[model samples]
Target: MPGAPFLRGDRVDLRTVTPEDYDFLLEHGNDPAIRHGAPAPTPVTREDLANFVEDDDESVQFLACHGETPVGFVFLFDVDPWRDHAELGCWIAPNEQGEGYATEAAALCLDHAFGDRGLHKVVARVFEHNDASMAVLDKLGFQQEGRLREQDYVRGQHHDTLLFGLLAEEFEV
Candidate 1:
């Protein structure tokens, strides 16, 4: 969405998430698809997001919009200035899944994190069962660094996580 001019694309629009995005955040947070990614209650109130976006955040968040409509959110975090490390994470609206939007948006974010932000490495840890996300990260050249056993407990069951990473020098595109 951000690659082209005016932050526009067929699948999404990349914009900053504002305090006004509370409604969208709440709706998406309760979404089953998003819950599968990283389950948490979306705060309906403005204060809910204030804790994250208030100051000069080392991390960055972007709201993914489709046309004039808001659809999802993406973020880059775990920014370590000393070691120059960061992590890439994203989530698409439930209705927008399996449409390649995530891949495209992620690529842009990764580029900015490593190329523009001067980060040396970007990492991601996805649930082992999330094949689609795993594929997207793989296509982006993120290698499987390790497998974390029982790293998460979600929906009343324990699941393993796959730690994936991509280095700045390793990016081909």
Candidate 2:
């Protein structure tokens, strides 16, 4: 469990990551299904996750939960208060996928980004092979901006990264 959820959605709640959440991330974050689109160079250890939650200040991260059970996490990276933009990243636990948890969590975060954070735009980069992630972005009204051909080499194969963006004026929430 987290200290207290900073935001809540229909199906999920967003909380700042806690040390206790590291084990959950270790188990689910390393799943091949979850890591396929978002590559992890090596298996992440507890210490690394601890550092990420405790030390990294460049990004804002939240763990999503349905009740007391963790469902996933959402992130706003490279946030530029001056530019009024940020890069978004999110993942659903393998067991928790396909239940709209990610979508719900994303909606909550996007609301925060455009409303509370006062960001003008938010961006996302998705692996070419992750159609599900693309669908989530589409459902959230993000427009396809561009593609970086063969931008990432993961799991012994090169993959393209598709960029998507949503402006605050375009966001429904």
- List the RMSD of every prediction in angstroms: 3.2, 1.2
Query: TM-scores, in order shown?
Result: 0.86, 0.95
TM-score, model 1 to reference? 0.86
The most accurate candidate by TM-score is 2
Residue ranges of candidate 2 with Cα displaced over 4 Å: none
lDDT of 2 by residue, 12-119 (tens): 999988888888888988888888978575888998887777777757889999988888989898899999999999999988889998888998999999999999
lDDT per residue as tens, model 1, 95-114: 88888888877877777788
lDDT for 46 in candidate 1 is 53
- Clashing residue pairs in candidate 1 are 13-65
